[model samples]
Target: MDSSLVMIGLTNVLSFNNIACILGGTLLGLFVGAMPGLSATMALALLLPLTFSFDPATGLSMLASLYVGASYGGSIAAILLRTPGTPSAAATVLDGFPLSQQGRAGEALGVSLFASFFGGLMSGIALLTAAPLLGTLVLEFGPVELFAIAVLGITIIGSLAQGSVISGLLSGGLGLLLSTVGMDLTTGTPRMTFDQINLFGGIDFTVALIGLFSVPQALTLIENSHQGGKVASRITDRLMPRWSTIKQLMPNILRSSGIGIVVGLIPGTGGDTASWFAYNEAKRFAKDKSRFGKGEVAGVAAPEAANNAVVGGALIPTIALGIPGSSSTAILLGALMVQGILPGPNLLTDYGDVTYTLIWAVILANIALLVVGLAFTKMSVSVTKIPDGFIACAILTLCIIGAFAINNSLFDVGLMLGFGLFGYWMSKAGVSPAPMVIGLILGPVMETSFQQSMLIGNDSFGVFLESPIATVLLILALLSILQATPFFRWLRVPFKRRLKPD
Candidate 1:
């Protein structure tokens, strides 16, 4: 807020070299994020050493732009291939690929691009103006509240299921079970590693993500080609969505941005949580719920906005409190450390010029994402039309390479193949993998918070009930579960009327 520092910051980032850094890093991030298994964290890590040559402010600006660009890039793969290019893109696959299948790939890409821009811009504004206010909020969330949040996040699997509620529950439970495969965080004992060193860290989420989504689709493409399924040709639909379409999706995009900010501000959760949460809320708010996962633009809009918004939201805590909100932000924090800029409450004060340059860079990068996406989204439609045979091979190679890249372990690759088979079977059984994926994501947060809360309360279950916020969240979670039942749907719950005859 200091005028002198603000002016210095503006001047630093606006320089031609820094602007070029923003553009180049954004382009690099876009390509990296569009590849399955590669992540923003990975890309930033690779780019970190190169920043040593640039001025501190300029180097920070480039990294910030890459972070913003990668947030939008993951949606590209989700739209084209039914595979999440990054973990945060998982929810995008639900609606994006469906629209692509319907030959509306260009429109889907456009919606995702604009939604990401809106969300990222909003998040950047919040970071610029409300960092201190939002940072204070971090203190209010104790372990109990976090556990409640995780519980609420888990319950949304019912909303994501979209087909059979029971099947969704089963899938979510399976995810929770799989999440326990890692070492026991509390006792320092292995729970389900099964004597395999690779299992010591549990399954890498990316490996599972690539295998479950990417491999199954690849295999399916092969099967469809063998069965003589029609291969769609390259589409040439207009990439720029009509103004009317943007107007209709604006509300969903706005709401999803808020969700992303809240979720990202929390230290442990990330964009993946925000995206899925936004997707569920969008479905909950829809007038025609059945349209979800079947080419609905709102479905694409909500997740894209939320996930991209998370980049800005996650940075608030990292900048204001020095607590990294997520892994990508943590790596960004590392970049600051490399430049001798330590993170803490005094971070902005000690290095106001450079820090503010980072903040402004995120805003500028979102604008860059819009420009690049508009020009490239239409061209990206080609990926949706690759011949089935070649597409199948490409997907398989990418998934395998991605899985192996996690730790250079053949075991991870084999695990990915195994999950691919399982995911294929789950698809046949009418079970949605989204819920299971949600379960895997929320499980650690739930387990850790619950255990920590129990320790604080001397093993009393009353600890969860003591907090008003936790109590309300638990009730909402319960409501989510109850509403998913056949009885509630049949009765229509709150709207059911008493018999007039009485």
Candidate 2:
């Protein structure tokens, strides 16, 4: 890396425009993420078209900050309303809402925000140190290894459906089906277009993301608008996490962050899965598991740290191997490609200075998130006070604009509305959209790699088993599925009983 170029890049990011974008993006993400039905995926999709016109560095810097902030922001409502703003926050509501009920809402929110910042910072540092090493390692992968990585990604979908891993697998299968709608990349043959011109390109992932995340949220908001009350009583003081609290949470935070960084290094696991896994593990490891769902501060701390840490974690492969760890970063990767920047080994060799600058940008962006997030924390809470009528109109407008903006195609606008109604129905049925989003993000990667691996092996029936990496991944996937079943819990009872007595 050229020291001068790296210095220049830092100078550029520190400029007023880039700094402002970082703050602005954080604020926007916080607001969207705090809303009960809005999600990080939806916010990213809505903002994607707008970033097209920005400097690649500026655009990504903003999105990166938003990604970090939004993940944290969801914990706010999870604490206050018993409604998680993002699926990653679902575990937060286990204990966060109870804290609010006890008139400790401010304390909970403060701890959440502070923990979020810590996790994000730690992850950023990890990204800076780890991305290059992992990226280079990934370069050794062939189709078999890549296919194994994709299957591991699908395992994350199971975590979202904790009690019924089969349902999660079904959701993933559906996503693979959807990915096949477009023309085949390898053969140029259309398999599932249904003879429609629009279907030739397949459903836009952004459109699906927007609808899957946002529309259901809008319906929930409409239903909940009438049942209103101040969800908090006296706000607690000492918004910052005290040293004692930090000490108590340190072990869990470290554990969860390790989970996040490792999961994030995988090609498709991303932050959402990291958050879920961290939340579950934190619960399992707690000395008093009973305290977990009843307002344990550690519950908020663990996932918050894990998810944000994923930001830096995901960036490792993105910077090193040129593959994205999450959907949001995948979109950013597309933006990089549009700007004619190749991401991968050559990037570090040829433009290590620029890469360092990008790492610096990540650090700067997170600092901005912490500062702006703390400053405007109270204001973000007030957004729920807006009338449902206004939210309906605003969301509808954004839906229209977001859809049309993607490809300047009115057909996409219709697609958004159609999926919007579909999402509404799905929500009413109690099917969380988080699984769907996970499935969608992992689907294409899994399919392409699966097909490619099969081809490389000359379509031999036993090729997957022949590959050690593939066999290990298959075992992990099976284990993940088994862990999600009731049989596993049933099997654990005798082991616990044996440990307890004669």
Candidate 3:
């Protein structure tokens, strides 16, 4: 809130060098996000080390731009092919593909691009206003409260699971176990390292991320190479929406952006959840609900708006609480640490200029997205025409390079390959990788905080329950767990039946 710091931040972000970084990052993000089997998180992880050479503000700005661009980019594939470029675009496929099939691909792309820009713009404004205030409030949080928050985050594993709650829990447990493979932080003792010196530091997260996200995708593409054809129908209509259509979708866009912001503020929820919630809300409020899945412009707008808004919303918790709101923000948190910057309450206090610069960069990224998305819509559609063999090889090569670049060690590459196979098997079993990634990211935070809380509480576990904040967080975690279970739905069914008075 310091006037001088704000001015300095604005000046730094607007500089030629930083603007170039933002532009380059946004273009790269669009390419990655428009490709099926690629995700923003993976792209950021792969490109994180490249930012190490830049100044803190410039580096962070680049990552922020990538995040913003990727959030909008996913809609390209969701509309063109039946495949969503990123998981966040899953809801987009419902209406996006239908519209494409009906030869309304251009209209679908226009609505998606415009809605994404509006959502991101709104969320950027929210981030500008909300993060500093949230940072001030969380400054009061103790170790026990932080530990409780971590637990609450972990509970979201059930919501992230692609299969049953049990599967999600198991995957989360596996990640936690993997996290413990390195030397014990409390003591110098090596916990799970089979005396291998390389294992002393544990598996590098970047390596694991590349393996889990990229490798399986490459394998899938290779396996499905036989069914080679154009990815989508030709887009032949106007690339921009009519003013009347835009006016009709304005309400849905606004409503969905609000939904995205709220959901993104909650730890562990991401764009995927926001998009689905927005789509459902749009359907519930529509005058003609039957038009929803069959090429409705509102349907495309609802999800695109929500997913893009999540980029800014997710950054709120990451910047303010040092708690990642989603997997993508988790990678962003890691990037901050890599650059010797710590997130949380002190972020705005110690690095106020840099923080504000990142926020401004997000706004700029959204503006760039609108221009680039509209200009490249026709050209981007041709990307899906590339052969699967070429795509698979390219991804495989990047995975190898990214994994090795993490530590300049072949051992890391081996670990990446091992995890890649494990991830592929997990996918085959219908288990979600998201819960595992969350567990890996949060495991150390939870352990260290709990340990510190125990020391503060004279080694008594009861201290966590004694704190009001911790108690509330723990209760929320419990509720999240219960809500994911079948028993809770069954219990609610009877109550709903009684209320209906049938």
Candidate 4:
């Protein structure tokens, strides 16, 4: 709040170089985001090396710009090509692709861009206002509260798991196990390192992120090439929806933003979960709910707003605590550390300039994304014309570089390739990588917090209910599980029938 710090932040962000960096990052994000298989996490991984040369504030501001831009950029391809540029855009494609088929692609894309901008702007303002308050709350958190938060996050993974809840839990449990690979935190005993010197430092989250997201995409591209696959993008003439259309969708936009913020505040929940929840809620409330799957404008707007708003909302927990809100932010934590900046309660008190700069960066990036997205609509369509082989090779190159750059480990490269195969198989089996990503990112916090809380409770099972927050969270977790069960749905049917006096 000091005048000097505010002045410094404005100066740093307003400088020619930083402005150029933001624009460059946004453009790169938009392009990478429009291409299926090239995710925001991978794009950030590729850009990580470039940040080593800049000042911490400048570098992080640029990265944040790219992060926001790319999340919104994914919707372009989801609408135009019927393929999600990133997994979070999957909900966008439900109505977006159909809009394209109906020759309203331009209007759909335009609405998406505007809704994304508004949602991001709203969330950015929310971050600016909410971060400090949340940071204060973070000061009150200990192992008990932290553990409660982690469990809450894990519960939201249900929204993204897609397949059997059991499988999702298994994948998440495996990730938690993998997170314990390094030496024990309190005790110095090495746990899962196998005495390998490289593993003594633990698996680099960035390397795992790149490997998990990018390599599998590369392999998919190659496999498709051999099968004579084709991809195409088309831009129709209509560029804007009617005023009536906008009026009809306003309610959905607001509702989706609310869902995005709430879900994003939970550590493991991400843009995909926000979008999915928003889409479902929209269907639930719509007058003609059956039209949801038939290219309704509200369908397109709901997820677009939700996903974009998630960029700002996700930052809340990451900045207030050390936990990441999504996979992309998990890599961002490493980036923050690389710049000698740690993400925690002190971020606002100690580094308000950087924090606010990042908030402004989100807003600025959203504006840039809209302009760039609109101007290049036709050119982006040309992406579909690229040879599948070349795209495959290019992605492979990025994956290799991305893996190696994380701690400069050759072992990570092999790890990336191994995970690549595993991811491909998982995709075929209808399993979601998102739950695993969240599990991997939040595993250490969950395990360590659980253990510490238990020790403090003297092995008493009732100890978990000592804190009101803990008690409430555990109850909510049970409710979430029950709500997702078939028996609960069946039970609700009778209640609804009685209420309606049938």
> Which is the leading candidate under TM-score?
3
Q: Give candidate 2's error at residue 253 in angstroms.
A: 6.1
Note the residue pairs that clash in candidate 1. Answer: none
In candidate 3, list every pair of residues with a backbone clash: none
- List the global CA lDDT of all models: 0.78, 0.72, 0.84, 0.76
For model 1, how does the per-residue alpha-carbon lDDT over 336-379 read when each residue is reduced to its tens digit?
Answer: 76677755545667677887899889999999889887876556
TM-scores of all candidate predictions against the true structure: 0.60, 0.77, 0.92, 0.82
Tell me which of candidates 1 and 3 scores higher on TM-score. Answer: 3
What is the C-alpha local distance difference test score of candidate 3? Answer: 0.84
Error of 3 at 40 (Å): 2.2
Q: What is the lDDT, from 0 to 100, of the residue 264 in candidate 1? A: 84
Q: Residue 355 of model 1: what lDDT?
A: 79
lDDT score, candidate 1, position 330: 57
What TM-score does model 2 achieve against the real structure? 0.77
Off by over 4 Å in 1: 132-235, 380-502
lDDT, candidate 2, 465-496, per-residue tens: 88786788678877877776789989998889
What is the lDDT for 432 in model 1? Answer: 67
TM-score winner, 1 or 4: 4
Candidate 4 at residue 320, lDDT? 70
For candidate 3, the TM-score is: 0.92
Best by lDDT: 3
